[model samples]
Each structure stands twice: as C-alpha cells, then as structure tokens.
Target chain A: MKSLLTQPIFSFFVTIGLFYFFKIIYTKYPFALLNPVMLSVITLILYLKSFQIPYEEYFEGAKVISFFLGPAVVALAVPLHEQMVEIKKRKSPLLISVGVASIIGVLAAAGIAHALGASSEVVASIAPKSVTAPIAMGIAQKINGIPSLTTAIVIATGILGAVLGPGFLRLCGIKDPLAFGFAMGSASHGIGTARALEEGELQGSVAGLAMALNGVATATVTPFLIKLFF
Target chain B: MIESLFFLFCFLILGEFISTLLTLPIPGSVIGMVLLTVALEFNIVKAETVKPSSKILLNNLSLLFIPPGVGLMVYFNIINEYFLPIVISYFVSTFAVLYISGIIVQRLDRS
Candidate 1:
C-alpha cells in the first residue's frame, strides 16, 4: 500500500531524471538513434519490464503528464502568434506546401504499406503517423486505423524528424532559417518545431508556422484521403 | 494553480461535448485547442490564466507518450512480424513529404 501510494511521485521523478540523464548522454555521443525522448522512453520501459511493474501503476503519474497535452497544444499558439506577420505574408505558399506535403505523405505511406502487403489497419495507422497525437488518433479512428498504433508511430516519427531534420537540411545546402524551420514543421509536426526552435529564432518562428499549417492541413485532408484511397 | 487546472478541465469537457454533438472530424482535444485558440484570439481568456499551466504542460509534452509506447511490450515478440511494412511505410511516406514539399517550398522561395 505504501509503495502503491508513492508510485506516481516516483514515476514522475523517474521520468525527469531519465530525461536529464539521456540529455547528458545525447550531448556526449549525439547519436540519432539515441534521441532524448526515445532514450528516455526506452529507459522507462526497460525499468518497468525489469521490475515487472504494471503499466497502470506506471501510468498513474504519466497520465498527469498527458492531462497537460491540451494546454501544451494551446501554448503552441504563442510562437505562432509571434510569427503572425511573416506567416500572413507567405500564407499562400505556406498553405500550398503544407497541403501538398500532407497529401503526398499520406499517399506515399499508404502506397508503401499496400506494396508491403501490410494489413489495411497498418496502412491506415501509418497514414496519419506524421501528424501529432490528437490529430493522428482522430485520423486513425476515422479510417479504421489502430489509434494506439498510430500514437506510437506518430511519436517515433516526430522524434526522428526532430533529431535528424537539421542535419539533413545542412546536408542539402538549405541554410535559410525560415526554410529549414518550415520544412521541419511540415514534415515532422510539433516535435520538429521544438527542435527547430533550438536551432534559432528565425528557424523556430518559421517552424512554428509549419507546425500550425501541418496540423490544419492534416486535419482537413485526412478524411478526404481516407475516402479516396480506401 | 488548481483553479486553472479546473478551468482547463471544464474547457476540455465542453470542447469534447460540442465536437461530439457535431460529429466533427476533429478530435476533442484538438477542438479544445481550437476553442482555446479562438478564445485567446478574441480576448475571452486572459493569457495570464492560460499561459502558466500551458507552459508547464507543453514543456513536458514528450513525456506524455512514454506511457502509451510502453504498450509496445505486448507485441514485442511479434514486432518483427510487422517490421518490414512499418519501416517501408514510415520511410516512403516521410521521404515523399520531404521531396515534394521541399520542391514546392523551393519554388515559392524563388517566387
């Protein structure tokens, strides 16, 4: 009973501690596969498995983290608001980029899934995997995709994009902060936008723009794609 | 802090109810976000009340997924069963977005 009562507190601190630890390792090694979020999650999962801790117990505190997701999403408006003028100026191009990218992303994922003979459900799950969770889950639920599966896929994609996007941009000779930022946001969503912010203000600002546009585009287009493809 | 949490809670529930009634394609939390965004846009909700809690929440957003991802344990043994398809889908789709959108953004930048 004492352990049960203290579980939430323990889990919360464990998460924080693990994150900082992973950050330290990430700084030293800088491996793409050892992304902070990825490493932290793997660490937590391993801890749980080794201890044979039940998920419900672990989630007691973790769900507290989720309760904040709504506000976190709302907070995204801050960066978006700060970048409003530039976003307004390039609204047309931004919309086009997001719309085209989102559609192509869906088709490419779905196409490959079909080619690989993936179950229809797996195809649907991947369809919205690039979008953030709430939207990804919505897309999944709509098209008979597995919502849980989509959530996992979405997080992995976000982390990967956040970690690798900047390096990829540099490799491609794209140095414009706005371009780099927007590309990351459009391709990766919030996680990528967060990473872009770390790169610089200009990158962060434009990345925020991309994140907002991507969300809107994915939400609007997901339903349409489900109909057209399936 | 507690009051702000309650306000967000009520707002989320309200957003869920409205979206559900309309059978909107958007998810409840997203609708909640849009609602809050609009409220902020119109000055209905003061930033002071909203910003504090939102920051705390947003800063730790990545942590939220850990619990869900742990569910992967159930399918650990069969992970490879779907490995090829998931990998192919993830890469192809991601690359598609990158290539096509990259071109469009480049063109727009030129213009």
Candidate 2:
C-alpha cells in the first residue's frame, strides 16, 4: 500500500478528488469558517490521522501541489503588466494609498488587540496580519511573536477581507475601480485579489499591484511600527 | 500536463533547497517567488515553462490555506481568550484601512 502511494498520478488524482469533495461543501454551505482551503485541509488531515497515514506519505503528492505557488504569483505579474499604463498614470496615488493602509492595518489591529486584553505577543502577531503569509511571519518573528500564530491570523484576515470587501466597499461609497482594487489589495492580499479579479480585469490588476505593494509596505512599516511601540 | 507537473516539482525542490540555504525570515514560498523572479530576469527559465502549472495552482490558492486554518482548532483556547478584542480590532482596522485609504487615493488622484 505504501509502495503504491509512490505513483504520482494516483497521488495527484486522489488530492484532486479530495479537493472536489470539499469544493462542493464550500459551494453549498459558504460558511466563512468553512472556507474551501480550510475545509479541504481539515478533511485531508483527518483522513490521514484516522488511517495512520504519515505526513510524509501524504506530502508525496501534496508537495507537487504546493510547488506551483511560485509560478502562480509570478503569473500575477501578467495581469498586472497588462495594466502598466494605468498603473504608471496612477503610480503615486497607488503608492500612497498602500502605504497608509499598511500603517493603519498594523496600528488598528495591534491597538484593538491590546485594548481587548490580549497579551503583547498576541497583539504583535496580529499587527502584520493583513500582509501575505511569508511577510507576515517574518514581521511577527521580528517582533518576537509566534510565526505559526501569525500565519493563522494572516489567513483569517485574508479570508475575511475577501469575503466582505465588496459589500463593505459599497457601504463605504467606494465605486472607483482603482480605489476598489487598492483597498482590497491592501486589506486582504491574495484572497481579496481573487475577489477583485472576478469583479473585473482592471480591478484585478490593480488589486494584484496592491497585493505586491502591500507586501512591500507592510514589511517596511511593521518593523518601524514595532520599534515605535516598543 | 505531465511535463508541466515535472517542471513544477523541480522548481519546488529547487525552491526548498534554496530556502534551506538562506537565512531569510520569510516562508519558502516567498523565497520561491523571489527565486522564480530571478530565474525569469536572467532567462534561466522562461515564463512559458512555469505558466501552466502556476495558473492552476494560483487559481486554487485558497485551497492551500485549509490545513493551517484548521490548525486553529488546536488554538481554540488562545482564540477564545482573545476573541473579542482580536475580532473587533482586526475587522475595524481592516475596514478603516479600506475606507480611509480609498478616500486618500481618490483625493490624491484628483489633486
């Protein structure tokens, strides 16, 4: 059985099969907490745990899936590149908005966490929660917070921002494409960018730009914010 | 499809190896991104080679987050302890950033 697991095609189809099963639940239920990724992962983990399947055994296939993240992010550059003309025209505004949003995100999250009686570590971990996972982890680690916890917070933040951003933007009276894109990117990262893409190409491109800029901005700002606070 | 999968696996293994060598504080995926960027810049790899696999992976990027999110189940105590403040602060701040930044950018564009 273990030897049979080494077949790449078998592993590939099995993972996809698992993903399809959860994707259905995700579509049918649409619960915030029951996010497709979260659901699929839980299902996979539980299946492995119950069957005494080691992570190594599962990773044989899962790693193939994970490997594609790099090129995926790079491909984002295509949509973004296509929007270069608009991006150049609005470059300054985009930069300023992303910068301000990053600072506000760090301050707002940290301040509220502190206000609600969270430990210093918890407060700090959530400070960079809006950025992508890798950068968020680095920011968290830099400020002496737990990287694992920071990853969790960042994912939750991304999902919430993605799910709620459009309705919230309408509520806030933001209808401009560039404005919508920047706000979603700054607030949510990739998940929100996905939502933005579905809305329109221009919005998606701007959101992609925002996601990259947010990564850069939060990385630069969070350390400074940490210094200012401590 | 098979060839695309092979190239992707190689890219990931290379990324993992590079990540292990580097002392950067970021995740391997981020490092992998950087590595991919450099490879593209130098023409060590063409965008076409990675495009197909990357497309499929990124389209379903949200799926990757599931395991870690479920890991939150283990941290229920920590979450419960900080639930109110975290939720309130995170959402309020998120919305504020969206609203304020949108206004600021639009204003700047006009000015």
Candidate 3:
C-alpha cells in the first residue's frame, strides 16, 4: 500500500480524479462556492493529510500537470489573433483600459493588505494577486514574497473576481461584451476568462487578450510599485 | 492538431530562451504569447494552424493551475494568521478593480 501510494503515477491519477469529481459537482450545482479549483485543493489536501502522505510526494506527480501552464498561457494568443478586427478598431482605448486596470488592480490589492496590517511579505504576495498564478508566482518571487502564498492568493482572487465581476457589471449597466470581458480578465485572469467564454466568443477573445496583457502589464509595473510603496 | 501543438511548444521554448538571455522579469509564456500574436498578425503563422490546439489548451487552462494552488496547504500556518487580511484584501480589491475597469471601459466604448 505504501509503495502504491508513493508511486508518482498515483499522485497524477488522484489529482485528475479529484479535479474531475469536483468539476462535475460544480457543473451540476454551478454555485460560486462550489469552485472546482478551491474544492479540488481542499479535497486533495485532506486526502493527503488523512493518509499521512507528505505534500512534496504528491507534488512530484502533480507537477506534470503544472508543466503545461506555460504552453497553455502561450495559447492565449490564438483568441487574441482571431479577434484582431475588433482589437484593431479600438487599439488605443483597449490598451489604455488594460493599462489602467493593471495598475489599479496591483495597487488596490497591496494597499488593502497593508491597510489591514499584513506584513510586507504578505503585501508583496498580494500585489500580483490579479494576474494568473504562473505569472503571479514569478512576480511574487521577484518582489520578495513567498511564491506559494502568492499562488494561493492569486487563485482566491481569480475565483472571487469570477463570482463578483459579472453581477457588478450588470449593476453598473455595462452591457458591452468587450468591456465586460476585459474587466473580468483584468481582475480575475484565466478563471474569469473561462467565465467570459461562457458569454460568447467575442467576449472570450477579449478576455483572453486582457488576461495576457494584464499579465505583461502587471509584471512590468509591479517592481516599480513595490519599490515606491512597499 | 499535432502540428499546432508543436508550434506552440516551439514558441514557448523560444520565449523561454529569449527571456533567459535578456534576464527579463516577465514570464516566458507571456512573451511566447506576444510572439505568437505578432506571428499571426503578420501572416507568418496562419491563425487556423494554431487555433484548434490553442482552444483546447485555453479551455482547460484552469486545470493547470491546480498544483500550485494545492501547494497552499504547506503554508497553512501563515495563511491562518493572515486569514482576515487576505480575505478582505481579495474581496475588496477584486471588486474595486472589476467595478472601476468595467465602468471606464464601458464609457470608453460608448465614446
């Protein structure tokens, strides 16, 4: 039993199984709190804890899935490419909105963390919370924060942005899909873009563009912000 | 499909290579994204060639984020201590960014 559990393949299977199980539940219920990533993380942690298995062992296998994140991020260009027509139409406004949102997102997160008495390390981790996990983790490390903590915060931020963004957009009477998707992706990253995809192709494309641009914008600006503020 | 995936991997590798050479703080994958976007825009790479694989990958992009997220368990102690601040910052900041961005972009779109 010990050998079987320790096998790297075992960890791989478990991660995929748990994710799919939670994904099914999320699809059936479709509730904000039933977020698949959140649920899968909880379930996996509990499973390992109950069995007395170490996290390092589990991550050894699970890292295989994580390896794909780079290429997956690169894949965002396809949608951005497909939507070039609309993008070309309003290049200046789109770039301006993404730039403003990126700055505001990082500042707002770090500011809130500082105001709430979080340590500087925690504030740095929160600074990249709006970007996707991979880029957020990289920025967190560069800015002298714990990458693991940044990953958690980034994921939590994504889930929260997805849950709240659309409703708030409606409340603000923002019906344009470009505006809606860009805001969602800017605030939430990949998960928010996933939700945007549900709305339509154009929305999804713009969201993908926003997610990628925000990642670049956040990376470029976060170091300066940390130097000045934190 | 195979060719498209191959192109993506190649671009990813090239992006990593350039990023390391330049010592840029930006992630290579994002650099790869920009590279690919330029390629498509300039007709260096046809959109259809990459579209299928890109769609499959992006659609399941959230799944790839799980391993790092689960790594959170290792930091439970620090997180527990900072729970209130973390939760508050996440909620307040996310809402503020979303609301502000949406409003600004919407107004810009109308203009």
Candidate order by TM-score, decreasing, is: 3, 1, 2
| 10 residues in a row with least lDDT, candidate 3 chain A | A156-165
lDDT of 3 at A111: 90
lDDT (Cα, tens digit) per residue for candidate 3, span A1-230: 98898689999998888889888998899877777777777788888888888889898989999898888878888888888898788777778887888888888889988999999999999899988777898899999998989887887777777666777888888888888888888899887887787677778778878888888899999999989987
DockQ of each: 0.44, 0.37, 0.70
Q: What is the lDDT of residue A205 in candidate 1?
A: 55
Provide the TM-score for each candidate, comma-separated: 0.84, 0.76, 0.91
The C-alpha lDDT values of all candidates are 0.70, 0.71, 0.84
Query: What is the alpha-carbon RMSD of candidate 2 to the true structure?
Result: 4.9
Candidate 3 error regions (>4 Å): none
Q: lDDT, candidate 2, residue B92?
A: 90
What does candidate 2's lDDT look like per residue over A1-230, in tens digits?
A: 85665456655666777778877886798655655554565676676667666656566666666555555555564455456677779888888888788888899888888878888898888898888877788889888887777877777777778777778888887888888988887888777777677677678768767777788788888888877874
Docking class of 3: medium
Per-residue lDDT of model 1, residues A1-230, tens digit only: 54853488887888778877887898799876777777787788888888888777888877776666665555555455555666677677767888888888887887788788888888888888777776778788888988878877777677778777777766776666666778887777767766676676556657656665676688778778877876
Q: State the displacement of the C-alpha of residue A151, model 3, in Å, after optimal TM-score superposition.
A: 2.6
Cα deviation of B60, candidate 1, in Å: 4.1
Q: If you score just chain A, what TM-score does every candidate get?
A: 0.88, 0.81, 0.85
DockQ top scorer: 3
Per-model TM-score of chain B:
0.78, 0.70, 0.90
Docking class of 2: acceptable
